[model samples]
Target chain A: MARADVLPLPQRRAIWRVMARRYAHLPLLAPAVAVSVAVFWACMAVLVVMSVYPFLAAGTPRFTLDAWQRFLVDPFYWGVVGTTLRIGVVVTALSLLIGYPTAYAMSKIRRPGWALACYVVLFAPILVSVVVRTYGWLLLLSQTGAVNYVLRTLGLIGQPIPLIFNTTGIIIAMVHILLPFAVFPILSVVGQLTSDLKEAAMDLGANRWQTFRRVTLPLTLPGVVAAAQIVFTLTISAFVTPFLMGGGKVQILSGLIYRDMEAVNLAFASTVALILLALAMAILAASNVLVRRSYSRAEVLRT
Target chain B: MTLVGADRVEDDVELREVSKRFGPVLAVDRVSLQVRRGEFFSLLGPSGCGKTTTLRIIGGLEYPTAGEVVLRGQVVTDVPPYRRATNMVFQHLALFPHLAVFENIAFGLRLRGLPSDVIARKVDDVLQLVDLPGFGTREIHQLSGGQKQRVAIARALVNEPAVLLLDEPLGALDLKLRLQMQAELKALQHRVGTTFLYVTHDQGEALTMSDRIAVMNQGRIEQVGTSQEIYARPQTRFVAAFIGEANFLEGRIAASAPDGVLVSVDGLQVRVAGDGSLPVGAPVTVSIRPEHVKLGAAAAGAANRWDGRVQDMTFMGAVVRATVALASGIAVVAEIQNDAAVGLAPGDAVVAGWAPQHTVVLAR
Candidate 1:
């Protein structure tokens, strides 16, 4: 309190002042926010409406569980689910096994700009059309292809292995495409770790192998889970890789949906698409739960 | 990496004329120093003064370009950090994120293929020593900052290196925490009685913790002495200015007496007694600590007296400092107790003086 009610102008500290919020300008964003909510509701309504359609025949849509029942009872439909799950699991595991070290190397690279350039080159193939990227793999994994040629030259095999136009080809191509997504998440994760932590461990008494197994691997698990989630979901919903590389030999849920739609069976196609969506969500939900449990455990041990 | 316990007291590590060049810059000039068994030594200086570089050289994190680093009299110039008998606590602490505190502390033991039981025992011992006993199973993120620092110290100390190097270990903590950790660290060092080579730019830290501090400047050590010696009688201007606050007055010897010299500054003579390598008529600078200067109407109470105008007075907690200008136009700062005093306005006349022997003479 002061005689003039001045109060000494209460210390104008740099950190004490709160930044003024932009609430004064909120009216400008009101339309966009409203539109976004409306669009989201519209899409949900459409998905539900399409899911309940009884037939591909036009006119009024009717509610029915016939397509859902068909999907549940058919052994082939369940096999597609199994195949999708298998591919997703294999791709995620392979990415982790191969991607962890790749991400590790990328993070440790002395010349990061040059390493980033290399990463860009490695990531270039992921950006190309899936059909083209799959075809490129097809050309490589084919019987008399470049892979066989190089292997033969190196004396690894007497002849080409039966690889292309099968699940093997589909998996190979899908992994190549999905690897970048996995690698990016993990590389960013590994980048966050200071190499000093590893050095500290080594100085404490850990050797090279133990340091990797104990410190490096566990520290980068969040990146691994994030990468797994992205790669698994992307691989599960992949239609082009299986279409181009599977050559009809590997009829995944996406490909089956495509075929059903081509045969004018919109209801069956939608049903298959819905099941694919559900399976992907289930896998993601399970993986998320696993990650959370491990994360909390890691967190607990850290303290 | 064999310097330990009883053997460490017998000159464990030696750097002989060791120098390092980073590109065109000489990060560490040719400098030779030795670590005695169970002695605590510090390389103290400001940032880029090469104290950390020298510590890194000793740690084998950075190799010397010229001289050899001898460990237990055996040259370890080519040896790596892990192969040396030393562990360093980095400024950042660098605790492993994913590992439990126990596992992080036990990491080194596990690498040597120790049984899990042994590792568990060693980790427990270190945790107990650091006062975070039974905290081995906690996650790194869950630990508070101070606990994390303790974990880092425990992690490094568990290896029982003959020489433990700490690079500004207390830098990350707040002021109060830093002050508390300083005593604990010093006590820990005394208990272990190993050769501790610590690096710090903080003058207070170096003076408080080190048995002998090697004051460094521009990639070279200016002086190595105990804190009392470094503070009471610094050999160089840099050490005097860096260690504590001082008022430097440029002068020249006007007359040489039996046991002192009459220094002429501006137009008046200041009776300064010093034992330094400076000749009569040689340009010199007198460094007098601020606290030694007395202020008031001490017109006849000092060897030298000057009438000065009180320019400003700042009341810092615990101490009050006044800027006074001599009649001959030389300004000197004096610090006094900050308790409520009979104050004078800024333009008031004042007399300031100091005893003869309180001044230190520097040639360059």
Candidate 2:
């Protein structure tokens, strides 16, 4: 066989050209890349540039630490940061608590038609607009809505309980929005688990609950962690659900940034944006470390 | 029904008219079986023959749509798998991947709320019994195939179950390892004295390991007997074809004598013993094992003899198999020892014969 290294220059150049031509679909990705750069990266760059500029600038690009310093030292901004994190943590926990069993049931459904129906139900909210879904929750949680009316008729309480215009409403709405995220990854993992393993667990004298705790739970932990990461990060940066459901009662970081931007205080808005970005990054990094450690632990058992 | 070990009539497990249905398919159809105490009984069949389903029913992992499961004289038809005094060694050796060898074996003990020290001692004892000493800390993925198999068996045996159900546990191993595990499992059953209800499609494994085997076909058992009885006197065509190599000759009963029956196949008369109850002129099939057929010089003084042409000769390591074409156009295979059948060739004319007792007559 003729070695490629020893081939004539012209022949080698021809082969290289042929290999390069094999990737003819490279230009097909141009539109997606262009949109990503033009919209997301450019906006982020502008935000970063405006964040360092001095506050109350009169058409002059003078740079200072005034915006960053004020935001960092403000106790109100700290409360906003804490609220954002609390909402993220609470929503993530609720989603997981509810989603795990739903996904497990979906995975165990043997009939294709029933499983397809479940898939449609899971992704139906995603197909609808987020604003529409939040409005649906708004109607459900309102004082005179069906829930309160039913509770009143049943004489469960004397007065209408506060559900909307508070953290409770935001949490309920966010969990509904993020449940599909939590379910899908866990569902895929659960679907991959063989029936034989479960049967073996039972045959080895482990009851149903013990089998789920020891075998099924541990095996699907990676998926659960992935779902948590997605839900947590998304809830941290969420705007529309909190804005609509909170009804100005819940002061979150994203709402503060939006308020600062609406007032045309670009410097302060950019500063709040940067703080949000940093917090999201920090939380994601911490979770990444936790996920990696857990993965390695699972890997040890596997190997 | 002459039980192989009739001295002890107490049964370890019994299935009475059990039937299981999946959708429209009857997986196990009204099957009844009895496993005596301390006996190694095998449900032997081809794939999809419902042997594994029957074993799973005994393990309580599968519920029979109709009938009862009796364990140690108690009707346990509705008992779940965890509540039963039975554990299974799965076909794939489904050892818990997350737990170490020790924890996997001690899972049942821990569920019973046994003390740590007692659990440890029991796990250690089972590990040693399975010849896996000092392997308690090793994870499942770190073990070899045979080691994993031992762990699976050990995991079940540690519970000290009254009946150990094995669902083709050695089916995943390679040929050499499968043979080795077969002998080890048989020895382990002997030492533990637990009734073993084993299920396998491999005839060789069933024959070598089982004290008695129930030959299953479709969804029902054809016959249940000792390996020798199953091999020598199969009552059904499926059993005769499934258990080993047999050359079947279709015939009718020519005469019934005090000692045996005379079967007329084509134009030839074949004498068969042990089937004298088969009425004369009844249609029957005579099954004869390949090794039982005497060829050429060995056919001298035989009760039934025939002239045949050797069509093909195959040299297996231990035995030489010859495909012989008889005068009536019926073909039969005969296996002879390699040393004695060295000179036989494809075109050679030979006289093939089998003793009257070697022939098994089955009604069509």
Candidate 3:
């Protein structure tokens, strides 16, 4: 007899019920996990194999490290990698400087109608096509565009400045596109903060600046780190904004990938793609350390 | 340049005709009170009664719309909370979750630009004072409820301000922990001798911990006195009802005597202790405590006595509360020791009475 048959019928059913409750979430998680493993992981495996093998000739497959070596040793590719990281860092920093204040102001808005309006304004841009938004930036930031026209009318500039077809245009457009990502995480954390903490700090004889530095900023660092990670990865991996705004002037990693793929250089494109993935993983790992450190104190671990 | 009666060095905090209006609602009406140095003063009221608002006004967290806030003999009505010499233990404690216990207590000192060694020493001292000596390195989330309460108190007390404002810091703890913290807080205040301005809606807490309590209702102070005075001789109906349980009997003054006055409630003349100043035929409400109502032979020789039948009885832990209906059909609850009420049950004949002094008369 089976072990389950040794027990009464009700007891056997109760054991099955306990097991169903234990692993109930597995069924709910099936679709997402299935898609991730099938689409994402399977594609990643193909990308890894493609990066190692330069060409697929008829009968026998030939594998070589020449693409990796050539990409790693080249100064031009390294510069492209550096530019990608630099733009990512600058965009993330600028977004935080602008997003923190916006999130703070939104948190302070008491009227629900006004708050909803603010949210609409902040997130509505996300619904628009990224290409259309980049085109809008192009029209505004061009030499004879509205921005230059306004500056010239105010005599702020004697001549039109080069705003497009460069890193500056890419950054401006990318920051605009990715701003909501930065604000959303920080807004959630800021909204959860009670005013009592600020009051407690002031009551302890700390001024406004001191309180912000010692209490407010430290408590919200996890949100800031999360925003930085999201903005950094999105900025680095961005393709269309950089392709349109850079106008072929800025050669970032993604741009290099696009260039190689356009020339049918599949091996080199796969190498660039893997390098970008590695960079993102490194930054995410660093951010995870920061998030864990900040959360270790803020969250209750056990009784 | 000090105004008369306004600058009192003995008073750690004084509010003169302070009022706070939140839009259409008057959160705190024209309220005035004084908190003496080294005394535990409490503002006791139900929620939305403006006790916390009044405390905040004194702490400089809220500005009074029409009056002066004098702290340590200085008119600081417009002074910001950071500039004022007061610290508050918030209702939720509000300890910084990002910092360890030591850093939390040292926040004020560090802001003052104290030396690192001094800050550390002071933090350690306060940690020990709050009975958490080695908890300096512990994160706030690691603490139990009682420990967190102590940490919050320590964080405020370390500043050594002119006064410490506590806004129901013990409101979140369980009953047993709350009672323990109450005793610990009272003893801590006694040891430190810092003037404390406490706000709580718990009457028992206010009575046990406060040297004086200001009973508030509907944005106004009904009365301010010691626990004994506030409990024994409540000046208003709100106070008599809010502070503790009371039996209210509404009636008209029937007659007056040198000893006391008699208030007739539905033709039942209940004698009350007073100077007989109330005119006869005037309306009044008589307040009596259930414990003061004696039943059975214990009602003998009382100034005001009534023969009644037991209508209902409830068994409390140490006492039995028996509701007695008088011959006139008026019901009054009588509390007796468990042993004394053992033989009593519903439908039993009983005499309910109380002394004249035990009856409090309030004008209706």
Candidate 4:
């Protein structure tokens, strides 16, 4: 190949123009990437550094494994980790079960105005602050709340069910808060699916249920997986909803971090925070693998 | 007139005055037609003329807002598609993306809760029937467009439906592939001996593959006849123009005779052989196919000969289409075989005429 400098003047100028055109998007992307790296990664780095600091040291920073060792040995911290994982899995499952049908209905709305109205209703809770919404759930699930009042008047139950200040309350609130995230991805995927496929299924002697099971459900798996991954990751890292709904009874990993930070045990707080991050990453990685497998299966059908 | 009466139990599919309204749009008007058992029937029309809607109505995918659908001598107007003995091959070939070829073909059988071995055997048989024996393990995406089409047909045929409804199944294929599939589909219908209710906008495909065709226009069947009859004796102005190229001459009945009707078009009298239903001095339209319009010395003994100059000549492969302007300033197109007219050119004086029996008279 000829060297760039040895090329003719006009050729060199043309190559320069082409290079400039190809790489022009870099300048536009630089500011956003730089800011994200500086703010987010720098914070993570500082958290990792501080987690290794000596437990009792004051003036000078000294590295030690005390925080990690203490966190690893404590059964209480293990319980918190287990509880957090349970909540994440349960919330993600419940959200998918509820969100898939809602998204399907939204996708089938033919008129744009009606679809927009349905989307607004589905996302209305998300427009409110998470803390406020959790508090709203708290009121709804209270002993004398509307739900209990209706149930009691109907004589379906003799007493009010214990709906708040436990894992049940936290799960219910978190699922409600994270529903829109799940619905949007599934809705978009369902919307992109051609209507002819459904008609074809019906025409091929499949009843509505059979069509859903054999055709629509399998084709929309990628959307389901994507929604699961998003809801699971978000639920694992969520703080405000758990704090408000758990009511001091459900001691999750995030709650432990909060308590440790309030007691000025910075090293301990950092250690728990890092463990939470690792657990979230583990779930996300597994979900990503599941998504890729399902995606490849879907890609095969597209051909 | 109804093609099939309620007593015609041999008819596989019958639409008796079927009508469908989607909001304010009338998709299918009061259409009545029939498909004889084991016949290859086609619903041919332009887009938005309700051919697909009529196919759907016959398949029981859409219930008629008025009239009845009789499938195999049973009134099935309210029956769902799954319960009806008909399966449709969609235009886009909607193969299930998640399933392999075997599963797609076995879908209907599996829904009926057949044994796994029986489903497998039926799927294999259908695969052989469509000529794709070893494609069971392959995903739908692995198949080419033509292969996908074959799979879709196999998926429907494995059910052993009384009638197989096809909604423009070859509309997506290239011209060469479409022609190949058209021939294969006709042969398949013959081998299976099933009533095939097909839909298409392409007149060539319709004429080539169908034993009989229902020419539809504006949500109504303009005429229903064998391909030869449809081409030779179209009943209405729409069918005459929609099926093939026709040179229309606006006229009125000058006189009625026992042999033929005399129509005067722009002061030129032309004799047309048909049942003289219209009285003298009534408005009418005369349609003549281009191939019947002889040119030059070939027009010597024709009774309705007119001297015209060729305005334009298009050299098609087998024939040359010439646009000739008559002495009355009306343009008539004549498609002459290239072998017969070797050096015909524009601005040449020509006499274009056709036998009086070939002229089709229609109400305006």
The model with the greatest lDDT is: 3
What's model 1's interface RMSD, roughly to a tenth of an angstrom?
Answer: 3.0
**Candidate 1 runs further than 4 Å off:** A1-84, A105-119, A140-145, A149-158, A264-275, A297-303, B1-9, B22-25, B71-74, B252-282, B294-328, B336-356
Candidate 4 stretches with Cα past 4 Å from truth are: A1-36, A55-63, A299-303, B1-7, B308-312, B339-349
Q: Of the candidates shown, which would achieve the greatest TM-score relative to the real structure? A: 3
Candidate 4, residues A7-28, lDDT tens digits: the string is: 9999999999999999999999
Shift of residue B49 alpha carbon in model 1, Å: 2.1
For all candidates in order, the CA lDDT equals 0.80, 0.89, 0.90, 0.89
Q: If you assessed candidate 4 against the hidden native complex, which CAPRI class would it receive?
A: medium
lDDT of 3 by residue, A1-303 (tens): 499899999999999999999998899999999999999889888888887876752434589888899999999989999999999999999999999999989999999999999999999999999999999999999999999999999999999999999999999999999999999999988887888999988988888888888778877777788899999999999999999999998999998888899998888888889999999999999879767976666544211
lDDT of 1 at A198: 73
Candidate 2 residue lDDT tens string, A81-107: 889999999999999999999999998
Instruction: Put the candidates in TM-score order, highest first.
Output: 3, 4, 2, 1
Candidate order by decreasing DockQ: 4, 3, 2, 1
Error of 2 at B177 (Å): 1.6
Candidate 2 per-residue lDDT over residues B257-312, each given as its tens digit: 66888999999999988747877899999999999998998988789899999999
| Clash pairs (backbone) in predicted model 4 | A303-B141
Model 1: per-residue Cα lDDT over A142-205, one tens digit each: 9989988999999999978878878788878877888788888888878877777777766665
Could you tell me how far off, in angstroms, the CA of residue B86 lies in candidate 4 after the best superposition?
1.2
